[model samples]
Target chain A: MKLIKIFSFLLVLILFSNCHREDFLQHNRESVKSITGTWKIINAVRNGTDLTDRFDFSRFKITFSDSSYIVDNSVPFIVTQNGTYHLDDPQYPFKIYFETPDNFTKELDFKYPTTNGVRNIVLTFSPGCSSNSYTYTFQKIN
Target chain B: MRKSLNYIKRKISWQLTIVCAITALVIAACSITIDSIDQSDSINGGETMQSTLHVTISTNAEEDNSRLMVAVLVPKVWNARNNASISFTSSITDGTQKMTAVPVGTAAPQGNGLDWPTLINNKIGHGGNLLPGWEWAAFYSDNAYNVGGNINLSVTVNIKIKTSQDNISFKLGYVVAESVDGLSNSQYYNSAFPGCFRVFGTGDLIDFCNPQLSTVDPLNSLDNDIVTLNFDGGIIDNALANQSNIFLCAKGITTDGDTLNLCRQDSTTQLISQGIKKWSIDIWPRGFFNLPADKQLASIQYYFTDATGNVKVGSTGDGSTPFTYTFKCQ
Candidate 1:
């Protein structure tokens, strides 16, 4: 009975150690990649206007790398803009930020709360005009 | 086979342990987190962010074109909302010399002629186009006539921005008869009087009026002169017209005040077929309001009337003949 008890204790200790080792290995492999690619400006709206102008339907396109982006105002690559971007992810789901030369910084947050399981992202910004309200939505591609 | 399997297991275990250690290190290195995020949802990133935008706008009064140009400097970051919506307030300088010159040597639409009524109609405060807040008031200083026969006249110009409560007052200095010799030095040529001048009947300075001093040879001989004016300082190339007709007239104000008796009195004695003489003054501003910013160049030309009343003969204004310099802004 003494020998059996000793063997049982050793088995428990080995299992516990192995489990912790596996957990540590798993954590090491987790890494988030920086997003870089083409982004489409789905829609833009100027608040407080009588909705008389066709500016609401206007769409823009942008391309971003790790460092810089461009705003194009011509055809084929209509309204290509270049700017800088940053990221914030204190919470589980990460947030994106963009700053243009016009001294405007857009802090983008997800409209629908995301969790660790979320593979796609949608961020929104506010204060579209001089008013207290704005909403800019962004989606992750690739 | 059993020995190989055991060896592989050992290697896998060691790899796992290394990976776990690296992971822990990474998390520890990146553990820092920001706190006290802005709870209040302020628009435009708050007042501190909005105040970062800086812009300076300058408006130049081009009374000749009846337009005021507003120049804006947009910092590289912020884009302009509506560049076309920029506005301007008008101002005028009338140096009390109602008698400005008319160039008879050039063709109509490009030159000034004996049409005093129309010529006087197109100035800054005239033509019924004076802005509501812009009033034409003339003030003179007795300094022109002191104890001695020394002339030191200075005219006061009041420019008020009707849209804003702010107003600016500047003085346009005049020249004395003795200082007339200063005209020979192009750098120091000014009108006898500077400031807005209303025609005798009208209460506003003519929209297109400029300073004029004339001398005539009434006996049809260049040696016999009627009036001689020497400018102490004048704006080099600023003009009321994109293309201006500059002139130096020897004029006589008739007692009737109905007709302005005038003749082209050139320094030369020979009388050309067409009597009227004209000049075209061209000088572009070196740069915007900041004068010392650029190197400026100017050109002067003299014209004599042809049979068709067109200016044909062109000469440089080295002051060899009676000539006037008219400056225009682009």
Candidate 2:
């Protein structure tokens, strides 16, 4: 009887610990790898407009690390912006979202809406933004 | 007994295998059923309209007791009493004359007709609405104050300012004085600059040739702001004052003069091929880098400064002219 009791107790403990282990591991599957290096903008499509010739992003750079990111559009009139970002996968084709210092959040589910990948990628201005949404498509220019 | 032991061992092994299989199934199922976290709504429409950025740029380098004595007279001449106040102590030396130095924090004798002009009198906006490179201060020393006098003069002035929600502003200001003393008998006053630029490369320090000064000052309507002395492709002859140790300097007619200097250099191959220059120093009374480049020349930088001394202001990290630069080679 004592041996039976010990086995039963051990079985219960194992079951309890394993209950949520799988779920937690699954939730963190997309974030185990480092996504803070550089990303190249393959192509962008925005709002039925082809605005690719508007800027040059060949020498651009997108740097993300330590909860901050800098998108330096390496061109004249450098359209550089820096803030915090979030993602579902934190990897290639990562679902990216933008946040500002004042806590304004904007999502870039994919790329742009106007110009296809031919134009430089631009992060568009979102709904309720008083300023015109400018789209910026960029490949990581490391 | 042996038969019973075998039965028990078989049961335990079966139980363990069953548990492991269940665990794998649960893990695979959990991974498939995972929900993506919503990170998009965290920062939407969050910024409130920001109040204007308020700031007053002043130098702490010249705030000794002797300097305060001289500063007291600045308000008298500039008539800035209503906009600000000036005070000094009898213990401080009057840098201009042999008068007994006043104590710290004592108010100076107001000059006849001394009073701060109304903000309207200033063409520049108030509450921090001034342009980025403008500085204004009303100074009153007996006008006889000269350098190297027993009375050393330093300055500190405060002005109200404001900023926009994004912490960016259309205006800025600083406290500075005008003296006719940059190089003997040369009066330094603020003049309008079209803009200013910053240039610095690795070439500044470890040069293959002799040392030379490069500038990035942009003066409005004056070709003098865009000055350059090239030492490349030829032997710099010292007989011609042609040594690469070229020195450049500019003095403003007022406090509006701006200064820029090259701070660093980086070189690389085709992977990262463009040059990246960082702004290293700003000597304007009101510090700013609003000047745009008039021309882009390969192997060179275009910018301006009031005088050559301004370029070297922060060379030793003294922070007097506080700025730095970076250069990228690829």
Off by over 4 Å in 2: A1-34, A40-46, A73-81, A88-107, A110-137, B1-330
lDDT of 1 by residue, B230-296 (tens): 2211223222112223333322222233222233433221122112232221111111111231222
lDDT for A139 (candidate 2) = 48
Q: lDDT for every model?
A: 0.28, 0.31
Name the docking class for model 1.
incorrect
DockQ values for all predictions?
0.00, 0.01
Off by over 4 Å in 1: A1-13, A18-30, A41-58, A72-81, A89-121, A126-128, A140-142, B1-330
Question: Compared with the true structure, what per-residue lDDT tens digits does model 2 show for residues B223-271?
Answer: 1111112212122222212222222222222223344333322211001
Worst 10 residues of 1 chain B by lDDT: B217-226
For model 2, how does the per-residue alpha-carbon lDDT over A14-129 read when each residue is reduced to its tens digit? Answer: 98887777888887775343456676654433233343432233454678786788766433212225789766563444356677666776666544232434323345442211
TM-score of each: 0.22, 0.20
